[model samples]
Target: MLSTSARLLRLASLLQSRRHWPGAALADALDVEARTLRRDVERLRELGYPVEASSGVGGGYALGRGAALPPLMLDDDEAVALAIALRAASASVGGIEATSLQLMGKLDQLMPQRLRRRATALHAVTLSLRTGTPLVDAGLLSELATACRDGRALRFSYRKHAGETTARHVQPQRLANYGRRWYLIAWDIEREDWRSFRIDRIEGGLQLGDLFAPRPVPPDVAARLERGIAYAPFACRITLRLQGSLEELQAALPLWCGVIEPETTTHSLLRMGAETPEGLLAQVLMIDRAVEVVDADAVASDIGRILARMSSVFSRDGARVAP
Candidate 1:
């Protein structure tokens, strides 16, 4: 007999494989009693799988349409994903290479020739580097993803950049992966605006809430999240104009450092932030291109103060400061 978790997973797969399942047949297939099957179905529901159940004679459970079931895939894209994911697991995690390889071979044998070619060729070129990023809980990621597919609300404590944690109520819109980190772009129910939350920084367990009506998502969710990250709140936001087009600057600089926008055919605008004006100036000085500070309001004053301080230091101890 399969373990409880494994059985539940099998049940979900069986339910998704077909629209309707007879309760007795499903129970027999799993070699579990009818009571056990019922319990497993309920467990799937709690995990955000929209498992619909019908009671009485000739009734059973069905995995509702649109449920994001990653276990038993029936779609071609999903089959490709399963192959790639197994490969990634073999490369990144320890003690599972052999197991993953065996599973990959089995899945590949079952896949149609076209899909096998696509997944294998794609996996061949991509490199998976273990960068020592924070270990995000896969179960948490799965739950949140299911919530997004179901348009469910979520409540959890989110840690800020400053390390302060606060409660958040949100209607999740989408999950965006930028670089190695995962971010949730959601409508902040408390703040009544859209906000982005880093999945790694979300504390403890999530509290799944009632389903929310779908709202108009941004035309480009990844771009919106990029802007959110680029202009994140800081003591000072530094703006710089440089002699290059946006494309040129973006290719040269790391995305985490700042955002680049077009200004003209020959110029681009850089928007970045630092905790202090001096810190901001230090970052600005690192850029290779000649930059013109473009802060037009109060931030310009702070920049001036930093400039004045630097000038005084350079004059008082030119030899010591520069050399």
Candidate 2:
């Protein structure tokens, strides 16, 4: 018979694997009396695992999800799958910051020797097929996230593209990850308006101010922020009636690429802001589908002229022609 501590470890693994188990069934599977099982459950609860219990004949135990995640048990395949996923997430395709990499680091440190070998072999064979770019510091990202979660005001110096530097005091709200970058949506204290700041542009001396209640935000604050980002290049509103499923549209477009309002199950109203006519025209052309450019005629007109010029160039050069 296994010792009590060994039995408890096995029980924890079993419980985590099955997710939920009837009290009697679990006791039988562990080859222990129901009373022993009860003690083990108590021990698990004492160890900070929220093992919820239900009453009645079908009563059982299950773990409750929480903000502070508990240690997870994974088999060989599961571990390999997680490592591969983390490697992909670390790449530029998804705006996933080094958070996934940090978690992977933790996982690697805790992995057993055999599992570590397996992870290493998997990583050696797996190719990301992506060119990684220098990203914002993970330590800074963690600090900003902590400040946001604590509802603390932040002070950071920011640099603009034109080499202008300014100090900012903001009530940090949400940290949004978009294609290779992290953006913070915060209430700019000095400007007296909500503004978005790039994590890459933020300098040191980021102090967390006194905690305060977070301001009410929209149900889809991310979507709104995405619209702002996608349209930031233009000083005008550009509308398009997209002819695709919401999932399809969202999959093709980044969360910060456009302001997508669900029009129906099959389509959505996408409004993108642009700072220039040329930039606005290029945004629509990227869709390259049967989308009707609606709001600003300047965008449609410019796109039409651009496409016509392209058509002439292709005809002259005898390049691959669009049907």
Candidate 3:
């Protein structure tokens, strides 16, 4: 049994950790009888903590929203981890501007000098290497995140890579992050389909007419759809024998870039569909590692034409060009 002071601190910590706790479970967690737990609950109430209790199996003890915000409980590691995350999230000028920087500044003022220095050192040493075409509006991001949290449909205009535009009505299911880019997995209302939209390309997001009953999202839905898109519409499928392990190859190329499958312990097959021979050759040559182009003959004629054009350009400049 803990002393009264220790037990009271533990009780406060437990309440702050979660939204609700069943009376029995709370008693067990505190290692005390139900009566003792009740007394402790009363003590908290006397301290101005609004504790609510309900009767039945589903009933539990929960602290209501107080007149003012209460202090949070975080162990050493949790505090350090939160500080690191806040620093990184603040560095980006992205489609969604996060308020983590302002929050970080506020928290730093309250944090011990030792922890503050550690967080500052980590942030100072980190470097970012990503560059993108444009910034995503933070307002639109908040609107979409709010809709997802509230279980609502959204209307938005999406711009494709080719510059074509389309309107989408969707039941926003979940948002995911892949390679610093955000994606929304939603049930498309107009097409009666499930679709994924790149958050960076969404132009206008508006609340729609009706709310949707949420549906189950398939496990690894993003991976499956990205794989499908990699080879779906291209006219030609070319295979390459890459000289690397499956994990290394996957790191170099995203799932949407090519259909990658393992062949053995170290080797893998890359299946890519291309619109033209020129485009196919350009992609194959960019693998950046030792690889054999097994079907070079299929696109050999087009490669020759590309070579001839390159030769003419080099001759005009009188420059030595490496094939």
How do all models score by TM-score? 0.57, 0.68, 0.70
Candidate 1 vs. true structure, TM-score: 0.57
Instruction: Give candidate 1's error at residue 13 in angstroms.
Output: 23
| Clash total of candidate 1 | 0
Q: How big is the positional error of residue 64 in model 3, measured in Å on the Cα after superposition?
A: 5.5
Give the top-scoring candidate (TM-score). Answer: 3
**Order of all candidates by TM-score, from best down to worst?**
3, 2, 1
- The lDDT of each candidate is 0.80, 0.77, 0.75
Could you tell which candidate, 2 or 3, scores higher by lDDT? Answer: 2
Number of colliding residue pairs in each model: 0, 9, 1
- Runs in model 3 deviating more than 4 A are 1-10, 18-40, 43-68, 93-98, 127-134, 149-151, 228-259, 262-268, 271-323
Better model by TM-score: candidate 1 vs candidate 3: 3
Q: What does candidate 3's lDDT look like per residue over 3-46, in tens digits?
A: 98788778888998899999889999999999999899889888
After superposition, candidate 1 runs with Cα above 4 Å error: 1-135, 296-323
The lDDT-based order of candidates, best leading, equals 1, 2, 3
User: For residues 186-234, could you state the per-residue lDDT of candidate 2 as single tens digits?
Assistant: 9998898888887888986597788888798667677667765766545
